[model samples]
Target: MLEYLPILYSIFLVISLCSSIILLIPKVSLNYVRIHIGVLTLPPLVALLALIFHVDNIIWGPLHFNTLTWLMAVFVLTVGLIVQRFSVHFLVGDRSYRQYFSLLTLTTAAGSLAWLSDDLRLLLICWGTTLLGLTLTIRLKKEWQVAKKAASTMGRYFTISWFVLLAAILWLTQTTGYWQLSQVMTQDSLALLETWEKTCINLLLVISVLIPAGQWPFQRWILDSAVAPTPISAVMHAGIVNAGGILLTLFAPLFNGSIAQIPLLILASVSVLIGTGIMFVQVDYKRQLVGSTIAQMGFMLIQCALGAYIAAIIHAVLHGLFKSTLFLQAGSALHHDQPLKKSKKPASFIGKFSGIMFGILAAIGFWAASPEDAYQLISAIILGFSVSFAWMQLIVFGHGRIGRISGLILFIAGALVYGLVHTGFHHLLHETIGTGAQPSIPAFLCLMFILFIGSAIGLWLSRNRTSRGFTILYLWLVQLGEPNQAAVESHPKYLTQYMSQGGKKDEFSINIK
Candidate 1:
């Protein structure tokens, strides 16, 4: 039993890949979805059973049966079962059902491989394949416009994440002269490198991990790809988002050094705040779900950074189960033409006041949780408050006047809080220092004032506006600039010149003569 664990996973991967191929055959019926789900479910379940059967031996290996890994395994299995059930009902009689199931099998296999992989090369291969499977799944939507846009966005995200991972792997090989996870885990060579070299390597690794976790700047892809079918979204959030945490966990030994761990922790904490902030502003249920997943992934990374491996894994697993259930339910709601139900009665003033008081207490609790200096603590607190407010406002407003005002208020509050925190911690103001420093009073005040002015302008523009308020708010937060502006500015001239020169007929393709 002890010797067969790796072999079991390998066999499962082969069978899953084969099943994915078989699903592509035209002769295969939609019932193949069930079959594919069954195939996908076996590896993780069997692995757990194997571990149980050989508990002593399993616990003795490099991959010990820790609480985190066990919890993660259970969560993955639970999600797989839930997704399987949901797919059976939602995908019945659908034309692309087989294709959907095929991609799911691939994703499941990749996820399992990632979880069980103790080798870097195998892990990277599985990671890339999982991403590819997800991209293909996203493209399966019936609407050409939706599918095309989603595919494009997913493609960009997949490419960037893979590129970052590749660079990190290359750097690891060059510096440590090894690409194996077990080897990297054992090697302390990273500590021997100069501070700058170590910093560069750690930065690359953090970026590589972050891109897939849907950290900001690259997070739009997660939202865009949510246009994919329900189960795919669930799997992407529950299974794929956990990949970075798994990688970080496996490389835990490398992070024992203070220099290595501190920078990574800082980065992860920043991602957590950013992801949480973005999540609060999204109006669409799917996007909200995606944002929540991204935020949770960031939290997982932060746990790993703090060397709380078990805590991170536990959180990741629980998060996956809850998120998967929510996504599946949301999909069902969307399919049934049911809007999210709203509370009928307005809260009494006392209730609202109590809620605000609770929120302030919670903010203070979080501030107490921080390990940073006064400045960093205050900055984090303000950022957290701002995000929480923005999220609440978005939920309450839901694309109307209330939402715009609430969003504007949240933004102003966030800016002001940030400014205050910055100024209170750091004495200097006015000049933006390149290095990380304590927040200063003047800087905090300036940030608040600027943000308040901006919010006022945004609120003014949104009143009785035809455009979507939630979307506008998101654009302001993510800095996506303007939507459809490029097409408006350049498309007509390009189209006219190409048409005059007798270019290709396809609209999606460039029509150079």
Candidate 2:
């Protein structure tokens, strides 16, 4: 019965994809399609539960029904289902409403299929289809020239990433003599190739993943993508940008201990800092969220670099759920009608001292738990730093003694929740996801120490408003976080063209508002 889940999951997704095509029919009942897609999405989530109990990984035809693949399949489809359901009402009467749902569902289903597939050929086809579907979905609001420009920019990046991935896949299969990804990535197959060959292929794979994850040098697309509708932004952030972590986890064996990991680490680390700057500097709500995503993705990739594949997957899943919710609630972020109140400011001298002390203790405790592991050392620094930040922001800075106490309690509870969630995912995925090649301790410790000092110095400098370097850095971040000129509009010039072209009533109704 457990073995049959792969077949059943595929059937459910296939049926959903085909049914979405029916949604493209103008006369079809959109609500009916909504129910159909939503209902179909639930089965995969259920399938995930069953896979949790089934310890052995099953290769049912093209799919390797491991917990990792099944979990991701459930995640992507769940995000798609949410986005589609939200769009059903949110985008009503707008032009291309039906088309949006169809393409979204197509993209989601194809993405699920790609992961479930073990055959390299099937993965390529489904992966390509997913990209195409997303590209088209981004263009759904074609009447908006800005949206079209965003879609065009996205398409170009997707093409480049896809090609790089294709090249890597072809090279791997040709060298290993196996079209099956499960086989091609195995230690025996990897040993068949020379060291240089594996490194080159891994490098190519890294390049491909970076492009889609919105890492530095390739992140302009995500900033430009703010011109898209909120739901589109949600799906892009939630499902598509997670590709880097997913792909990296899948190919962790090939990536582990490769020299390529060093470059990936460097690039991703830079992206994290840059993304942090962008998030802080950006005024636009959507762009702020975009920056946050870039930062989050960088962290995910960083986890992958350290051979913590399962942890990276956990990050991707949580980030998707949290980021998608933020995007969907973007409109609510700025409540213009709400009264601006000046609240009592907290006494922060004591708070800052307390926070710093707590942070140091937390860092030491975390490091003690995994003193020998390079990745865990980094993780400890991050966790401790995060706890300190949260402690200061929530408890130390609370309005009064009572408020501070409440916040302190809440903070502890939140920590416990995080620990539980992390532990659960670790146990669940440990069997299917292998730990990749461990990184060198001396290199990571030295690198982290330098980075920590640099960050401290940078923060101190940033506080000096009169410094030329500070001003230049601030402006650079603001500019980087800004949307492209093509994606910006003083007015909907398309409105005039749309009206002139005699666009339909319903479309005009939404546009005129």
Candidate 3:
């Protein structure tokens, strides 16, 4: 029975892909959408069953089934269902609706295959397929010039990452004498490994992951991709973009106790600061959401760098769920009345100090809960940020004691969840998937202190509101992401261009206030 899990998973993927292709039968009734949903449901259901059955490390041919693979499979399938249903209403009259479903399922299948493949070579191929499927989906609005440019820009960035990934895989296979993902970890001769080889492999893998995750320098591509339809944006944010963190987690064995993590940590930290800073200044709604995602991904990578793999996975899953819902509901916010413009006073020093204290307490709670030998600094800092964000919600936005109580309960619950997940999943993953890392305490503390100070300065700036130097610095960062006027002029009038070319106006077109 256990031996059949991999085959069953493969069969389900095939059926999903075939059903999607069948949808492309010219003039297929819209009723087929329901059938397509049913088909898409099978794989995730199987994945859930496998999880329930405690199936792990089931490798047949090139495919692999482990806790991580099945868990991610379930997430991918759930998101696919939501996207499919959302599309049924959103693209009701579009001529290319069937094509959109086709590509969507194909993308899901590719992503699942990548997640499940045990062979590095097979994994790389699935990665390319996933990228291709996403490229097609992004260009669903063929007549929209902005969408075209977004696809082109994403393609360029993906191409660079793809080549780097390919190179890393090839080099790792040669250096470790292993083509199977499971075998690479057995090469225990790290001390004997050449310095250059280790650095090259780790650097290649980090760059490969960071670019797609929308880390600092590469984030503009994702923000610019707001031109794509909301459904595409939903999947892009919720599913495809998670490849980076997943890749990092998948290669945890390689990153543990290595200098490779140092550069990755630095880059991820910068992305977190810059992404959050830019998000505060964005006037456009979708761009702001994208900026938020960049920051969230950075936070996840930081967890990975700190050897908190389970916490990182939890972050990714939660981020995907909330971010997708946010993207789907974004248009509704525009329909509502905007708040009246008004000047506001900065937060009081006491209130600011209280928030900081709450944040520090949360950080300490997480650090104490973390595995004794594992890196705790990054985890602590991330917890601190999480608590500070909740404080902002309670004190900055919520009204009175009830809100404060709610925030307190939430902070405590989050701390408990982090502790449980870190301990339970750490053991479960180590037992089932064989990925665990323990980095140096001194190095981890150094990184943690830097982040803590940065958060303190950020909090101070928010409260002061009168710091001319910080204000100027913030504005300059925002301008880095601002669209160039000349570039906007170079493109055809956005939706108007499509109308002039004999295309009908989309009823679902998003309206920006």
| Winning candidate number (lDDT) | 2
lDDT digits (tens) for residues 1-513 of candidate 2: 766666677677777877877777767665665466666666567666656676257888887877888788878888888887777667876667778877887888888888878998899899999988888887876778898998899899999999999999999999899998889888899999899998899899999999889999899888898888889889989988998899888888888888787778878888888898899888888889989999899889888988888889999999999999998988789988889978757556877888888888988888898787778878887887888899987897787799889999999999899989999888888988967678765446545764686598678876797898888988999988887887899988877886797756653154212
Report each candidate's C-alpha RMSD, comma-separated, in the order given.
12.1, 2.6, 4.1
Per-model TM-score on C-alpha atoms: 0.64, 0.94, 0.87
After superposing candidate 2 on the true structure, give the runs of residues whose Cα lies further than 4 Å from its correct spot: 339-349, 441-450, 497-513
The C-alpha local distance difference test score for the whole of candidate 2 amounts to 0.83
Q: List the residue pairs that clash in candidate 2.
A: none
Q: What ranking emerges by lDDT with the best candidate at the front?
A: 2, 3, 1
lDDT of all predictions, in order shown?
Answer: 0.61, 0.83, 0.78
What is candidate 3's CA lDDT for residue 3? 63
lDDT for residue 390 in candidate 2, whole number 0-100: 91
**What's the lDDT for residue 388 in model 1?**
57
Candidate closer to the true structure by TM-score (higher is better), 2 or 3: 2
Best by TM-score: 2
For candidate 3, lDDT tens digit of each residue in 66-174? 8888888988878977888888878776657778889988887888789888899889998898888888888776666667777888888899999999999888888
